[model samples]
Target: MKIRCIAIDDEPWALTLIEKYVKQLPQLELVATFEDAIAGSEFLRKYPVDLLFLDINMPDMNGITLASSLINKPFIVFTTAYKKFAYEGFELEAIDYLLKPFDLDRFQKAVDKVEKAMLAAKLSQKSNDASIFVWSEHQQVKVILSEIMFIESRKDYTCFHLYNKPKLLTLLPLKKTEELLPSQEFVRVHRSYIVPVKEIRKIASRKVVLQSGEELPIGRLYADNVSALVKL
Candidate 1:
């Protein structure tokens, strides 16, 4: 997992320390550097900065206030001279607070936080994004890729019942989606319904009922493949 980070510190030595530490980690990429928090805010608006090495006691605004201003705040690890504000930093949901004159081991702890946060986000995206892209009517539309309960042939076009989306009329045939998607997950239940095996609620002779309680007529031609799926 790669984490794009920005360093915001007023002191030149502090910035140098951050740069050296960031270079040591393969997973971290130093996206931007700022001498002050104000300039850093402008840089962030233009580019997406994932993790921040922020300084608390800047000349004008405090790092805590600046961090709060971001709508989608990055993972913050406060690097400051003041040790008194450590508890307050935690209140901001900072990944870690690194007091000035901290060692390389302490810096690695902050980098670890970024790695963990990124892994969680990737897992969430995989679980939530069940949609797939398709070209339709000279435009592109995303159909719930997993919600494709079944597909049916309509002569030239294949109607994919991705439920709640006006039946996705694709130029490709029923076998196209099946071939593209995992074959182990989908089986041709009937000449019409190429049902996702996971969505099949129950199977009866001649027909298989889907989770939505819709009965799809199973064909004799596809019976052997359907029977193999049920055994697995």
Candidate 2:
């Protein structure tokens, strides 16, 4: 994974060192460097990056203050000569703290932590995408995508049929319900019915036979798409 990063330091030599170190790593993509903290903050507002190499001591603005003001904060790695700011940096949940005049080995260790954190974040997002939350019975309920067998329209409400569980009824129109489901996993076979693609056993005589042995009629408008599943 290419990690887009930027460095902000008032010292030109520090920025040069950061750029040189970033270029040595194949996974690191240094997008931009800033010598002014205020200009760096403005750039961050317009374009969010994955990582930030920030200097704590700047004449214009304090690095910690700028980090706190950001609405979408990136993973921060604070670089400074002073050790007093280490506690404050950790309080902001900085990935790592690098002392100034540090060698390449220390910088590589900080980047390793960032990579692990990014990988964990991606895995968590994938897990969240495999489920959905809906208001049911006056409380939000999590519906696992894999457990869904079919969906049936009931006027202004929709009923979810799941595997080995009681049916769930939610106050949503069929069109709204369809928008929440993944298209590749579920299909609208009729005006009143939506079935999981994997649960479909066969299609015959304009009827879809599910793996559970229940059959649903295919609507005239949706017959072409429903029949196409047989070709798969």
Candidate 3:
């Protein structure tokens, strides 16, 4: 699959160079380019891409601040002239840091890393879409993995909330249910709640909102899990 990408750099030459390098790779698609970080941030809010080529020293808002504020972050490659920002860039889990005057070979290396990461994510998601059997109503029930929205825990039972279907209440505990689901697809946001990562629409103010408009509280202990969700 082609990885959709966008470049944001205050320097026109930097943006042009990134565009040229992106065009050289068949696996990468350049969707847009911006010389203003604010304008690029707006575009990202409306359009989600797989990867980003970002310069760190733009005016008004630098790349580090912009990257940290994104709710849905893309794989980032920080392209800048300054070497001092390398630690900060990697701390944000950037795919690569390309110093100024980088050649096509260096750009290709960063793209290679992005491509590998994307492939791995796709494979993990595929594995999460497999069906599993659950005991409900004294019988074995077949549940489609992809249809699950979230799993809620009751005092002595676990509820499997599916899309457009009745929830299944089993005698199983939430901990046992968590063990059965794929770790990559399901996350425990609270002691009593486990939500599918893909089903999460937004996370704000210690609350996890699902795509269905259902909001669940993010437990104090699980707050870090919610933070990690955005990075995923």
Candidate 4:
């Protein structure tokens, strides 16, 4: 898999040099380049990438601060002239540190490290697919999709009703939780409810009856979604 990347530096020449080095590596694909650290941080939040080449010292926001603020952080490679920040970079478990004026050989070494790290992460993610993990009660809770009967949304938090198990509550938005399940398996009948399509036993004009005899209201906004489910 090609590693999608973005480079951020205050200096125009620094950005150009990283762009050139990224082109030389076939395994890397440069998505965008930014001269401002804050702009780069905003882009990363909107779009997901596999790697980042960041300069340590920049105006507005520094690289380390930006990296720490990311919700879903990617692998980071620190590129700057200062060697004093080397210790701080390693503390964040950065992929590699490249001093300024480095040659092609040094750049290749950094890319090689990213390649190996990405491969390992891919394998680990595959192993984690057996159960989805969400934070609750100050710890991560593993949830099996098949065991989930239905979901009830209470604004910021969601309640998960599982078969023969206590309800699990997590601080996840209803819309965000919907994106985690297979589209065909989970159907949204209301703005605040999501039920497993397989667990639905009956559907009325304004209510959905599940196998457990639990009834949930069908919101007007999602009426069309329930109609489509009936056709299935």
Question: For this target, which candidate reaches the highest TM-score against the unseen true structure?
Answer: 3
Question: If scored against the real structure, what TM-score would every candidate get?
Answer: 0.55, 0.59, 0.59, 0.55
lDDT against the true structure, per candidate, is 0.82, 0.91, 0.92, 0.89
In model 3, what are the clashing residue pairs, if there are any? none
Q: Compared with the true structure, what per-residue lDDT tens digits does model 2 show for residues 1-232?
A: 7999999999999999999999899999999999999999999999999999999989879899989898999999999988999999999999999999878999999999999999988865774469878878999999987788889998878999999999999997888888998786789999999998878998889889899999999999999778677677
Candidates 2 and 3 compared by lDDT, better number: 3
| Candidate No. with top lDDT | 3
| Residue 214 lDDT, candidate 2, scale 0-100 | 90
Over the stretch 152-231, how does candidate 4's per-residue lDDT look in tens digits?
99867999999999999999888888998778778998989999887899997699999999999999999998899878
Q: Give the residue spans of candidate 4 off by over 4 A.
A: 129-232
| Candidate number with the higher lDDT (3 or 4) | 3
Candidate 3's C-alpha runs over 4 A off are 134-138, 141-232
Q: What would the per-residue lDDT of candidate 3 be over residues 1-232, giving only the tens digit for each residue?
A: 7899999999999998988887888988999999999999999999999999999999999999999989999999999999999999999999999999899999999998998988888886876668888899899998788899899998988999999999899988898888988887889999999998988999989898899999999999999888988887
Candidate 2 or 1, higher TM-score = 2
Give the Å shift of residue 214 in candidate 4. Answer: 43
lDDT of 1 by residue, 91-161 (tens): 99998999899889999987887788778877656744666666677787777656786888889887888
Worst 10 residues of 4 by lDDT: 123-132
